[model samples]
Target: MPTALPHLPTSRLLLRALQMDQAEVLYRLANGPKIADNTANIPSPYTLQTAQDFITGIAEKYRAGEVLNLGMHVQATGELIGMVSLRLNARHHAGHLGGWVAAHARNQGYAAEAASAVMDFGFATLGLQRVGSQCFGRNKASARVMQKIGLHYEGCLREAFFKNGVYEDLLTFASVRSDWERAL
Candidate 1:
């Protein structure tokens, strides 16, 4: 199991562990309909307590080799712009990637940049054989991010996700280590 979450720096962003001090910022930026509507795990009414708890558990999960959740920040301004995560399945040498950008920072390629760094970490550092991601079919922005990060589209699972009182189709995407390396 990995002992620590390393800080990942991209050209425009820094990916690091979420800190307790940033709970308020996390709550302020994430507690909105736009973010919650697109993600499955984030609750509709994101609270400060939710942010604290999530941060509090990150270390333990990382120690267990189960999850890696990093806060995405702009390197120039040091602003908390979003988050990206890789949930591991060690037995299968695979991982599931997840992420979102703050509404204010959309369409700027930050999500793809940060996600690409994490995928590189997963495959190169963590020795993952494959990494996958899924988004609500309606989330074209997220799907684009997945593609931009080199994950090939898998298949859609019809009505596989139930969110906000409705069942929505889930679009899956993935890439094996060889394919990812070849694309680089």
Candidate 2:
């Protein structure tokens, strides 16, 4: 993706631009069995090639302003910890947030902390009227992160997503600009 994006800072983490050199790091963080089993689309057999392809492929999308993908790093050690992203839908003045943190980094509030900044970027910087996120119904940790970041649970679409040979309930959460602004 783009070599530079808005640098988002939190108490313990820094959300920086995604660099191609981080492909191996990302693959190791995202290719865990627990992560793939709980979410959709993360390949179980994650490879270096997959990481390279993604880093190379998304550059154009990032530069075009169609998407914002950030790399999460520990402020103290500069360790790449995870990622956060916001997808733009200009026509509808909306965007969607998606993110994942390494297993070692979970339960530490990193995801929620980074997500809050991204929500601000979506509503404040991108001028999106609304931003939303989706997680598998059984993905309680992810759901908690969404709620922790100020998104309210809107509803669920039963059997809406098929992952790993089974139909999954998709839980969608969102926050409008007015609500987000009021919360701050």
Candidate 3:
């Protein structure tokens, strides 16, 4: 793991770099219909090959310092239950955020807490001026996590994503360092 990529801990979760050993957990969570429906970039019918490819390809991103892809794990069990990441850009001072919790971990506030920790890393540690997240307009749970971490409702690109044989609007939310500080 790169030292630039920090392993952040919340009360119930540890957000750290994804290891090759986590392919099984990634396969389970990333393949679920519910998880696929919420993310814009994830293909439906996610396969073992996709998981293996993802594990292999993620190394280049970490090496380049362009993204921080962290697995969300339960410290007690050392089980991989989810994933959270910061997608960086050179032209933009902000990073895009995303995550997915296992079916069994849903509604436990792990997403929000893990998200908060990553946002803190982005703004405080990485010196990003802002952090943003976008969700399918219908993904209330993910949108709620963004709001819980103090990301304001910025705007929505109407009918921006064509997925699952339908076009859905995308809701964009963001939080400045000031907003994050206030939330603390």
Cα lDDT tens digits, model 1, 52-111, are 999999989988989999999999999999989999999999999998889889899999
Clashes of each: 0, 0, 0
Cα lDDT tens digits, model 3, 1-184, are 2446687989988888777777777887888758888886677788877888887867688678678888898988878888898888646778899988888889989899888899898888778888999999989999899998888999999998888789999999998878877877
RMSD of 3: 1.9
Model 3 TM-score on a 0 to 1 scale:
0.92
- Which window of 10 residues has the lowest lDDT sum in candidate 2? 1-10
Off by over 4 Å in 1: none
Q: What's the lDDT for all of these models?
A: 0.93, 0.85, 0.84
Judged by lDDT, which candidate is best? 1
Better of 2 and 3 by TM-score: 2
Judged by TM-score relative to the true structure, which candidate is superior, 1 or 3? Answer: 1
Which runs in model 2 stand beyond 4 Å of their true positions? Answer: 1-4
Candidate 2, 1-184: lDDT as tens digits? 2245688888998887777889999889888657677766668787888878877766677678788878889999999988788888879988889888888888999989999988887888778899999999999999999999889999999999988789999999999988998998
lDDT-superior candidate, 1 or 2: 1
